[model samples]
Target: MAEPSNSGGSIVSGVAGRYASALFELAQETGAIDAVAADLSTFEALLAESEDLRRLVGSPVFSAEEQMSAITAILAAAKIGGVAANFIKLVASKRRLFLLPAMIRGYRALVAQAKGIVSARVSVAEAPSEALLAEIRTAIAQAAGAEIDLEVKVDPALIGGLVVRVGSRMIDASLRTKLNSIRLAMKEVR
Candidate 1:
C-alpha cells in the first residue's frame, strides 16, 4: 500500500477532512455513497499501482486544467460516474488531488460509521489462509462487539506471527518483536 498522506485510517482532519466531509454529504444526499466509495477505492488502488498516475495527481508540475482533463478521461475510461465522477473532477480542478487518497479514506470512515462496522488493520508475516482470516475476523468481531471490516497485509520483515491494531489497541505477536526481546535479553546478560 502507498504511504498514507496523513494519520491513520480515515481519521479525516484539517483540509482533507473538510473535503471529505463535503464529498460525504454530497454522496449521502444523492444516495451515491456506495458508488462513490467504490470508485474512490478503485482510484486509490490505481494511485498505488501506477507511479505515473500518482505523480500526475500529486505533482505540481501539471496545471489544474491538465490534471482535470486527464483525470476526467481516466475516470470515464474506468466507468466511474455520478457524484463520484463529478466530485473528483471538481477536486482535481481545484488542485486537491494530492489529498484525494485521504479524502477517500475519510469517506470510507463515514460509510463504515453509518453501517456500524469497525475497520481494523492487521499485518502478518505472509498472506494469511482463508481459515486463519476467518478466525481472526471472528475474534475481532467478538472483541469489538461489532462487525469486522478487516484490512489485512503481509510484511515479510515480521518473519512470523501477526500484528493487529484495532484503533489505539495493538497486539504485536510478530517474530521481529520476539527477536528484539531476545536481543535485549542477551545484551543485559552479564
Candidate 2:
C-alpha cells in the first residue's frame, strides 16, 4: 500500500508521520483500521502502566529479532489481531519501536479526519449527568458540524464547572481558571 501523502498538512510531518502514514494506509487497505486503533489503545495503556516496557522499547541495544520476539509475544498474549501483531514486528525490525506512541496518535488523527468526527475532551470536578453529557455533545456537534466523540475526565482541582477542549480550541470555564483570572484582575487593579 502506498503511503498517503500528508504533504503540507497539519500532521506534524516527521519520522512519526512516515510510520503513521504507512500504518494508516496499510490499515485502510486491509480493512483493519478499527482493530489497529484498538490494538494501539492497548499498547498505549501498557506504555502508561509499565516503565519496563517503555524502557525495553526505547532500548537501542536490543536486537531487531529480540525486540520483534518480545513485542510479538506481548501482543499475542494480549490477544491483539494479526495485523497489529505484524505491524509491531515491522516496527521492531526497523528499530523504530520508540516511535510507536507518536505513530498511534497520528494514526488516530488520520482516522478521525477520515471518519469526519471530532473529539471533545471534557474535564470537570465531578462526573456530569448523562443528560448533561448528551447536551454538551449536541452543542459541540452543532458547533463543529461533525459528530463529536466525547471523552470525559474528572479533575477535582477544577473545583467546579468544566473545561472543554476540542482540537486546539479550549473552553476554560473551570472555577480554578476563573479564580486565577479574578486574582490576576485584582492584582492589576491594585
Q: Pick the candidate with the highest lDDT.
A: 1
- Worst-scoring 10-residue span by lDDT in model 1: 1-10
Candidate 2, 1-190: lDDT as tens digits: 3333345455646888778887888889889999999998998888899888898799898888988888888888788866777877888889999888888888888888778778899999999999998998898899888988789999999999999999889999999999999999999998
| Cα TM-score of candidate 1 | 0.86
User: Model 1, residue 137: displacement in angstroms?
Assistant: 1.2
TM-scores of the models, in the order given:
0.86, 0.84
Please provide, for model 1 over 18-43, each residue's C-alpha lDDT reduced to its tens digit, 9 standing for 90 to 100.
Answer: 78888887887788888888888888
Question: Each model's C-alpha lDDT?
Answer: 0.86, 0.85
Give the C-alpha lDDT of model 2: 0.85
Off by over 4 Å in 1: 1-11, 182-189
Error of 1 at 102 (Å): 1.5
